[model samples]
Target chain A: MKACKLFRAGDRPVLVDEDAALTPLCSGDEREDRQFGKGLHKEIAALQEMLYAEHQRKVLLVLQGVDCAGKDGTVHQLFRKINPMGLRPVRFDVPTVAETARDFLWRVHLQVPRKGEIAVFNRSHYEDVLHPIVYDRIDGPEAGCRYAQIRDFERTLAESGTTIVKVFLHISKDEQRRRLQDRIDDPEKHWKFDPEDLKHREKWSEYHAAYEKAIAETDAAHAPWYIVPADSKPHRDIAVAALLAETMRGMSLAFPAGDPKLAKLRVK
Target chain B: MKACKLFRAGDRPVLVDEDAALTPLCSGDEREDRQFGKGLHKEIAALQEMLYAEHQRKVLLVLQGVDCAGKDGTVHQLFRKINPMGLRPVRFDVPTVAETARDFLWRVHLQVPRKGEIAVFNRSHYEDVLHPIVYDRIDGPEAGCRYAQIRDFERTLAESGTTIVKVFLHISKDEQRRRLQDRIDDPEKHWKFDPEDLKHREKWSEYHAAYEKAIAETDAAHAPWYIVPADSKPHRDIAVAALLAETMRGMSLAFPAGDPKLAKLRVK
Candidate 1:
């Protein structure tokens, strides 16, 4: 459970399972869980203040999940109480003409939070690998290299004062079907409903496999991946928030003393 | 003093005075000031955590002063209690051949803190402007253009989510003489006694004029300059820490929320 010490890169089959949902923080009662989550939000907010006061490191939340698995929804729920000035929510859609001109990480590096900041990426550089591998635009060998590159990139970020928390929202296929059907049933949601979602749904299993491969290859202590049981929306938010709060607390953040000698000095 | 609202760029004469040492945070009691500094350090660290959690903006502490002005010591004392994991102390020295080949800011931009990281420059790009002008490597009109370029660079950084805190550690000429004499008297500290220090001391007035010009040209609402009274070291540290703590608090950092619907979910 202490991921900073135990997380290591593992093979795809060992690291990610297609049919598993781990609801670690679930209380089995929606109301109780909601109450606990509210408290956690307050605690998270306090921890965030310490992180800002310390202003020496960064935290990045990487949210990657299948469409309608609630990536965008998770971001909205987790950050509603937090001050908007400090949180930058970057939703990486398709690569733009300029973004594709360079390495995928060029744009990613540009978006990474500086010290005393937190950045949540709705979809991230992981998409490049996931899409290419799923669509067969990249071969297994090339995909393997990309994974290695990602691992190195992540480690570099971690080593350079970034606490990276990557969460993979795990939703059941049935949940996805319901979510997609609900989107179609409501006219107000039509704008968010892309026809491409249905086409991409056809290759869900392939995308899942691609995810497993990439996550397994890149998983490491510096940047740990969490597989949240997102089949239940309440469970997903609480679990992820709990994980973040715990990770932040472990950092041992404190206010810096400037001139401890000046600790008792009378300035004139 | 609401700095953000009132910090307008002024002319060199009004903004910077070579002979004045401003002890802005002084309360006239050393013990009381020290106690307050201790409390402020704790507050500053807490604010740092919030900044990191909010992770939307960056804070840059650009420390500039004459030689023997306690830049290194200031960085050490200010960050003594901070989590080293979140802080990056980047000392910018003479440019290397590769760095000189590129534009001046190319190397500087590379060292700028990413979102959520505090980058403390012991001496900074400001050195390029100061030394060159004093040494006459660049004439008045050229120096003026350099100042314009610096203004543009700082503005771009500010507009792009960087909160810059520039500190000019103001010390007396007599203090430099005493510090240099102490260094020479102690053979044990010979390694730190650079012959170049004496040469730079001879150009003290020119260096002060250069700093005054550069600061005046670059100070703005988004990136304000603090003139700290380094003649009184304790006052200097306490004032700077207080300023930084106040600046960070103004950022209003907090943890973010996502998907309000997930707030009341019952998980099993």
Candidate 2:
């Protein structure tokens, strides 16, 4: 199977074959996969220590996608290996009265990871652009301003040393239908479904358009958006793990040599 | 030097001599502490997997405290070790119209950790008893209702397998005054001080009374409050880590073990 090319759009939505056989990424390469996973886990663990010790770098992971796109599952599975001490996940919903009065980003900014900490936004600041554009909550001209505001906000965050990785979990509508149906058919899974999900499903095309535009406008060198295929859970997990591992590896962190004076002390 | 004793009402707060000679907890004696911190980290990691694999469990960590009491430092230091995936830290603030209109715990309940994930609230539901009671935001018989509501809410969480660990980072007023001065005098630490903190400092007695009442009323076996001495950062970190570790060790977990068919293929 051919490797899936990373999607980069100019004016249109980039189409991907949802059912295309996933090129065996880190899978067949078990040693590499295990090494990568273990190493990434260790590095994250250490990064967590650095975050605590120095409190210097703030990290944010933003996941945006359509229903059944595997945002929740991907986060649970891939991050399962991380220590809880350093992990924080924030899910954004409709703003409350106080939040609405502040700049759309205020509530979000307050939640940004402090230096050395990792904060995940299950759906994040992008919602300002995506929701407004899709729901006609803002006009095209207004949406343009919102998009720029988002870029500037993210730019400020990046400048402050926040490594932002935005993942757009791309899944075909057919797959969404199948997963939604699976939730509906299984009694135990019924809790996962919401009727409102269908309403959002009905406006699939609009959301897709909104997402494409949002990605195009905000994709930056500092905070790039990766459109990852989500048809296969294991494949998506492996791909995300690989992407995260690569990102951390690029950071080139060194574990602090223990304080020589403190290290020598025998506490008995 | 003796181990720090509990503070009684109408008495001076207990103070531990920072440089006093003392026996260190042995590696074997500290196994519970080591296991607690390591185990909690592992539990959180497992939960992250459960979040991904099964998408069950929303976890919430609520930290409530007085000024200079080390909420920021504890969260900064302790959670620094967890995996960043599927973890979120939410810092609760003064109630807005939407929050005020809802029951006291409404916003707190909304932020509960989802299955297989964890959410940390810098200050949480107990604030219903703490802030309101302290500031006269809620009073008289109504405050009684609020306390009962918090207990019920936490009980419901416990029944549903939501583990709640409430930590009160206890510090004496004298220590708070000293820390506040340190923040003011040290150029590098000046950013941490807010003039508004002085205003809260003035109301210290009222806040303490509120806290004592809240702790006495709401400390349940399911979600008991752990009061860690905040004057010593290392001691606090070690104690909190040990407590969290013990909590996770008690919650026995088993890895997915992979599919039996997949396991067979792996052997070849």
Candidate 3:
């Protein structure tokens, strides 16, 4: 099955129905599957080079997941073969003092991929909806307004020749607990360990509910969302690569045909 | 001699006195020099990773040169081994309608590197001063104002824990003519060929004078300018890498110390 269809969150997606451990695209042999994932990444890189040379369209990949759901790992894996010149990976942290002064989407709009570029957002404007809704900072009506604003914003980008791919890295509560425990156990990774993560984990159900609501309300044909099971890192990497490669392939990008008049021009 | 001292644009820089073809840092062997350049890039990549892990200070590299001076090539070579997650390479083109509406520095300010990030500008705010002066769009008084504004702007960034390294990729007029001609001759490179390059070539002396004025006025200890000889691509790569590596080494970046309180805490 095509990854787009295989992982697509249909009209109504229940968080409980998706199995985070399922690896439908994997060939069952771990080594072979890893190689397959690498191959897909190479393909994505080649396609990106063409898109850059074509210099016409833009590609934006949004990765959203609970902590330790492998958003960073997935990005590292996906772009291993790609040239940094053509890639823009943006990690949106908490809003700065200046950012809070402006509209929520203002900073985001500033970072959208320019023509002939591929931009990956580690966490994105989606955080605006997810965090506020989970923390009860914004009321339901305000949340609805933000969702409409996001839909309009994304539609504007799609209209301007940007292909948007939004992926939700789904991991089970058990998987999250194990990953959190590993971070706590390792001294080197203690820098990445935040006490606030425990507080957030306590509200896992609420956050999941928030994610479901955000995905359901804002998912559109132009900016499709994929719920990739991310319990296993390699599986998550493979799934994200397949989905992205498939997406870029659909763009049908090619290098520009040169001017015939320049064919005979020689360097002095 | 240290690259910092060797390429430093002194108090009174005469562009004519600088030899763009000089390879003072090279070992007089082509292959060895290329390998040495690669080694410096790796060292830079490692330093950048530490800087990202430190998550405190910021680094900004600004490249300014006439057309076909290999700005893009410098960036590509400098970042081949560095992770894109820690790198932000911004290419500033002509301002759009929205950008034109604001003060020149407004758009440039928005793209400054975030904490723990290294941002490289292929062409930068210097263009704001250089282009206008060369074209007579901004008069001497206005140019002086912009130059002072640039100095103040860079000082602000430096005070806020951003180490700025500005480099001029100095290529001879003959070298640029050959590069421009090569772009015109190769159909594959036709997409990069802009006819305006020939128009700009006619005003080479004006552009050089503008650059000299801008550098002399804005150069500071906080945001020092390096006049790198760039007639040979390998020489340019080596000088940039060495200067940047030296700058970062002075930062003393390292992984954050693990929290003592988390020593006994378990994830469960």
> Which numbered prediction scores highest in TM-score against the true structure?
3
Comparing 2 with 3 on TM-score, the higher-scoring candidate is 3
Q: Which candidate is the best by DockQ?
A: 3
Q: In candidate 1 chain A, where is summed lDDT lowest over 10 consecutive residues?
A: A259-268
Q: In candidate 1, which residue ranges exceed 4 Å CA deviation?
A: A1-268, B1-10, B13-24, B258-268
On the 0 to 100 scale, the lDDT of residue B6 in model 1 is: 31
Q: Write the per-residue lDDT of candidate 3 for residues A1-268, one digit (tens) a residue.
A: 8999999985576676259988888888999998999799789988988898898899999999998888877877888777667888988988999999999999999899988899999999999999899999999999999999999999999999999999999999889889988888877787777789898999899998998889999889999989999988888999999999999999998778889987776544
Model 3 / residue A59 / CA error / Å: 1.3
Angstrom error at residue A184, model 2: 0.7
User: Which one wins by lDDT: 2 or 3?
Assistant: 3
lDDT (tens digit, per residue) of candidate 2 on A118-235:
7778888888877777787899899889888998999999999888778887788777888887766554454456666887888888888888788888888788777777776666
Model 1 TM-score (2 dp): 0.52
Model 1 clashes, total count: 65
lDDT of 2 by residue, B160-189 (tens): 877777767777777777787776655444
- Rank candidates, lDDT, best first: 3, 1, 2
RMSD of each: 10.9, 10.1, 3.2
Q: What is the interface RMSD of each candidate, in Å?
A: 14.9, 13.2, 2.1
True contacts kept of each: 0.00, 0.13, 0.48
Q: What is the TM-score (0 to 1) of candidate 2? A: 0.58
**Candidate 3 local lDDT, B57-76, one digit each (tens):** 99999999998999988987
- Show what share of the native A-B interface contacts model 3 retains: 0.48
TM-score, prediction 3:
0.88
- Which candidate leads in lDDT? 3
